[model samples]
Target chain A: MSQYELAVILGMTAVTFLIRYSFFALGDKVQFPPLVKRALRYVPVAVLTAIVVPMVLLPDGRQWQLDWRNAWLLGALVSAFIAWRFNHLLAAMGGGMAVFFLWRWLLA
Target chain B: MTTTYHPTRHGELLQGARDSLPMLAGAAPFGIIFGTLAGPSGLSLLGAMGMSLFVFAGSSQFIALTLLSGGAGLAVIVFTTFVVNLRHALYSATLLPHVAALGQRWRIPLAFWLTDETFAVVQHRYGAADASPLKHWYHLGSSLAMYGNWIVWTLVGVLLGRSFEGLDKLGLEFAMVATFTGIVVSLLKTRPMVAAAIAAGAVALLARDMPYKLGLLLAALAGVVVGVLLEGRNATEEGQA
Candidate 1:
């Protein structure tokens, strides 16, 4: 690997470790205020949703592409419905993949 | 508090590993896909496997591979991966109360081994009201199992590369979309949570072009702020009434 590649890996490892270690590193020495704690609670759902929304809405990760060819969007909706009903991660994955391929084939 | 933990270290370790089977199932496909894509992902074999060994976050790894293949700048790749993983801080915070006394030896490795799958399984173990003190072993069990699973599958993907030419084109990534669907649906338990999700999603799309994914960073902050502010207002209104 080149110097730049090594730099990317090292930089990522440092930042990732810091975020993961923040609370443990702090331990009893520091305490989060109540409001910050409340906000922290919402981080998971909000962040995960944000990450996927663009993936679903924009196939190229560049712009909004809403059309029949966008099987990802349809599959995403189907996956959401499955998740709500079944509440199984693997099952939702399977169900969504099944629908995605089916939509792709049908559209083709 | 209902279930008793295993008496021995080995027993708890096995139990943690066993209990994580369902979650392991969820992470396996993604791991394999990453390995298969790694070469085409333009990374040296060392780079591909090394990332799984070190960075260890599935989503961020995939994002990094994508940007690297596209020749995105190193700073952009690093910053984007970092933003994607910001959620881990919340995961660490949730588990801190249970793990506070474990000290660095245990806590650091646990943090390193922690992944979305391990968190899902171990969080339940930690959240349970059981009087058992072996929750850390259980945490180790799940995290280590996830760690091992990632390494083994990446190797498998590397070995299976090229022969599976159509794998990436298969649109199998929809499985992740499906998995996130389940996660978001389950977690949207309140009004503020839903509001946060919407704000984050809207802002992410609007800010996609922002350099270094600053839009995503801002979106995450916006979501948290909106949720917390709404929660505070709701509590105040109820208090006055």
Candidate 2:
């Protein structure tokens, strides 16, 4: 809406394009070293963890308080356990949804 | 070994559809949510669909939609979308070697269609002890299927948003978190991986309120650092053993 907001949005777009374009533009020219390659292997796992963990553990804030209102932690556990044992996506999702719904109902 | 069962383009499309079911499962809901919310944010169905078609990434689309509704400038929208979609650069880079030999014509389309699910499937097929070109077909098949699913679901959301009201506050937003949790849990398969995930998650929690989605970037950095540290320690222990 404001000029400042416009600047931020456009700036983000430029940065994103720059990041993506670098890969295509430089990928053929640049050779990644072995250490960098190995490190890249772990990036996804780490990034994903960082994204998921906080959402489950501290849904609202950094208070670190766990209560019935936030069913994310329980749902995550249920899903993880099911996925570990059964190795099925539908099953894990279903288990999580069921737990989350049940937890919400019981707590309510 | 790679030559056996070379799938025709049609066959690849069919297979891509079937293989994309898991991706579609999450994609459909997310796409719809994006659609439903975009309308309330002052975007038209055409605008929303156009965004989906062009951007093709859910989070970035949502960010763009929010910026648009809030009357943010085009520059801001583009910049935020770029930052949010930065991960795609990493994704494309990782997938480059596997798809390199496909030649320029096929390479462009294939690269364009590559999504997270496609990347995972393609990476697995590439790693398997097979040299078949049909593996590319598998990637193609799954990607096209996901592409269709995303378009269709986004359309549904647009239609729903146009006709129905009051669906936004029905709490469909939680599905996003649920989907992310599912993805993260499934991806964590090893002890060090799990530890790194926890560390990053903790960091994200601490940095949740940071402006401009810095939390995600910081969390990713923290996770990488923790994983590298753990890996180094493990290597040393193995050497000592």
Candidate 3:
């Protein structure tokens, strides 16, 4: 890697650490109101949805294609269903992996 | 009213470490992935381990790696990763209520280890009213375990990235997303969460082609907007009725 790349990576590492550490340094002193408290509850669901949906839907890093190639999405959907039903992390993970592997094998 | 916690000597810190050990079980494999992947990006063994020790965020590290592999601009990579990790602010806020009682010194170190696993375990304990001493002990044990698991597996990944070449085939990369799905599924106990998730997913799909991680930002903003609007409408309707 070039020196610039090395410097960039190091800089990122520092920035990430600063963000994590900032919580302890500043978050403790501040208390949020009830409305803001209620708002925070939605954050994880929002952020997680935003992150997961795009990746599963567009894994090839192109225009959003809706086809059988998106077996990953199907696998994720099935896993979501299992998770909703069982409310267990291990079960959800196992179900997704099972469907994904099964799809890959059948197609191959 | 302010309640002050009594201070303890440095020896007591070991108790804190011992308390955090149980969480290592989940973190071990996760850390290994980070370590192994870091080397392929031209990071030295020490560099990989240092990233895990200092950064300690699996998703952000992976995001950084993706940008590095793509040979994207440094500014873009940094900006994207920063946006991706903005959720840490939310996690910190969620955990503040519990650690507020720990006082200042313990607060900083406790927050340092506040990964998703740590926050989940700690928040669960915090929510339980009149928790037994065993609860805190369990959390402390888990946190320490997670920390050790992270450090050791990171070293292993850095040193042995070549040997475990096919680990990606196992789809462990998807496990991180799957974990988030599981959490989202478990937490959607109300109408607003349902609306918010759908809104976010829709925005993400719509903005899928946006560059520089704008899709994620847009999706998150959409979710927040939808949630706030829905809740506001509900409150107003309740008042009128």
Q: Looking at candidate 2, what TM-score does chain B attain?
A: 0.75
Q: Which model is ahead, 2 or 3, in terms of TM-score?
A: 2
Expressed as tens digits, the lDDT of each residue in B1-241 for candidate 3 is 0011113333223443443333353355666777888767766666666667666677677777777777778788777767766656666776665555565666665656666666554554454454343344444544565666788888887777767765555544465455566656766777878999999999988987776557776787788888988998989999999
By lDDT, the best candidate is: 1
Find the candidate with the highest DockQ and give its number: 1
Q: What TM-scores do the predictions have? A: 0.75, 0.75, 0.73
| Per-model CA lDDT versus the true structure | 0.76, 0.64, 0.66
TM-score of chain A, cand. 2? 0.76
Quantify how close model 1 is to the true structure by its C-alpha RMSD in Å: 4.6
**Worst 10 contiguous positions by lDDT, candidate 1 chain B:** B1-10
Cα error, candidate 3, residue A103 (Å): 3.6
Model 1, span B143-207: residue lDDT tens: 88988988888888877886655555666556556666666776777898889989989988888
Each candidate's B-chain TM-score, in sequence, is: 0.74, 0.75, 0.70
Model 2: per-residue Cα lDDT over A37-92, one tens digit each = 65566666655565567667775546564765777778777877786777565567
Q: Considering DockQ, where higher is better, how would the candidates rank from best to worst?
A: 1, 3, 2
